[model samples]
Target: MKQYSFNFSFEVLEEFKKLLPVNRSKKILKKYLLNEYVLSESLNDLQEIISETVIQPYWMTEAEIIKLDRLIKQAKTKGYSINRSAIMRDVMNNLVDRYRNKPIQKSKQHRQTFKVPKGIKERLSLLIEDGELTYELSSFIMDGYVPSNDFPSMRNKDQEDLNFKTDIEVFDKMDEISSEYGFKKGGRAKIFRDALNQFEAWLESDPPKKAALKQELKYILTEYKNVENISIIKEEINKYLKE
Candidate 1:
């Protein structure tokens, strides 16, 4: 989606479920927008759009701001370019995966030490990817360990390496993310790019400017194809989002 210079604000909330409930429906008229985005119509219109869309406390701390500032400068010296919001997007994704998958303890009784062969995390990741136990990463390890006899069955399954292109299933959730951020228009690349570029708006015409965006868009579509790529790109872009 093409961005504008318009600005707006919202009283945000936390948790994805509250902001975007499963059975929610948008009551705004599609025709209220020029490109059909009620947001692009006016600042007030944009505010109203978000009033129904966003419900999260969203802000940056001074430490986060400083960290990103340094990252952007470092990346420039190394001949790279990215923006802060992209960096935050990546950080959020990593936090999600890292906390969601890594074994953790709510209390002492929750700690279940498991002795298993390598690639166990990879194996249990299936259950998480399949949405069997998103809230139970520790259970995955516990179950595999408590039933020592089941370890063989879990590991011996004739399963291929999780295909980053398809097996790493975060891309399917991109739509939910895009819609929440109000980039519900345009192709996948546009949605991703616009969300990352949410903080900036500069009118760029002429072939050179167009060419640069085209190149960036191409790189985004091809390079960020999977969860692994997303992780890698986030690391690189963290440096760019700083300043």
Candidate 2:
């Protein structure tokens, strides 16, 4: 038996943890390494990789190692030489694409009718009459029109800007997490980590603590929008608990 290791970020690692809960890492890697098309694509991606900083061990059987060596030699002969890390990186990346949490489709923007302050409504009407604005008054306002320097100031010292109530839609917080944490596309890993953390806590905590964690998990299930396959992961968690 031979063992191989590859460095990957926390998110990449977590994605694999959830995606292959029951399958061995070697089995997955062997499948990718033996595939000519997948191996070539993974090697091609190495040219632009900045490299991940976390190293994790993966075991490989003797026969799997032999096949990987052959593939490496073949790729080198074709002038597509790549290191083990590069190949593993591409393998993990492909797995991420195949198993990453997909966004749940939500409704598009819908028009909501609301009354504007008399002063603001009058101001909008005047703008329409001046031929400076083209859209209907409600549409223009709802579209979040910003007053330009050429236009008169909509705000005065005594009057505040009018607030309009708009329909609240199911919004995915993963986008914000990605931006805030400097993750380009791995924010969905947070959901998996959080859910697992809550389950772990529930397992060890006192009654009061368990009660809090229970509520926290429920809140997480409700608050984190657009995560698919959550229930499948939950089933895996349940299986672990039963064991």
Candidate 3:
């Protein structure tokens, strides 16, 4: 986090040589000037190198070297040790080998395909039943809309005079109720289609949504059965009246 500035010279190099091994002194000195490590001793070494060396160095100027020294000191205080070039080379090679051996991830662009489940089939069947139930409820309401000759007691009277407005209202209310139940078209047809698509994905990937889709299927089936029973009862009544 701390910034630094410095001037490089032979006197700085002498100071750096005191702390670094003789074999590594020049290499470490070059790295120090490169801002590889910020050490107090390295800064002193830079001063020594700059003062003793008569020929001007071309890699970095005195001002740049001074900046490098400050950075080295800051990095040292933060407990960061500089890695030697040889060490970095080995580490990079190991990383490359590990990456080469690891498995590649599948592309999201690939098309996903899966088989339909039996539960989804059952859901489709339930959707059909629900559709029939909605139609039956609609018929009940429609019957109230017009008078029927089957009602022998009221045969001579106008069916409209029977005042079945409440029956019509009840049928309209049923539609509102079904709409709130997440049934598009007053039935589970849309839900069935969606669940089938999700189920197919679950079969392919066995993702977490699979359990949720299964639970949803159970709910739809139960609701469908209830509506289907009501529809059947209504059908029976309508049939008897026709006979």
- The lDDT per prediction is 0.31, 0.44, 0.34
Q: For candidate 3, write residues 1-243 as lDDT tens digits.
A: 111212223343333323333223233344544444324343332223111221111223355456544554565566644322222222223333433445233212212122322354444334333223222222223221222212112235332211111223333433444466655552322222233343333234422233334545565656667768867766865898999
| Per-residue lDDT of model 2, residues 113-221, tens digit only | 3222235434443323322222112222222222221212223424323332211221133234335656554443333233223322322332222333454566565
**Candidate 1 per-residue C-alpha lDDT over 118-220 given as tens digits, one digit per residue, 9 for 90 to 100:** 4544534432233322222221121111111111222464433221121112233435444554654443333323321221121111122343345456655
Residue 79, candidate 3: Cα error in Å is: 21
Q: What would the C-alpha RMSD of candidate 1 be, to one decimal place? A: 21.4
Tell me the deviation in Å of residue 51 in model 3: 7.1
TM-score of 2: 0.36
* Ranking of all candidate structures by their TM-score, best first: 2, 1, 3
Where is model 2 poorest over a 10-residue stretch in terms of lDDT? 132-141
lDDT of 1: 0.31
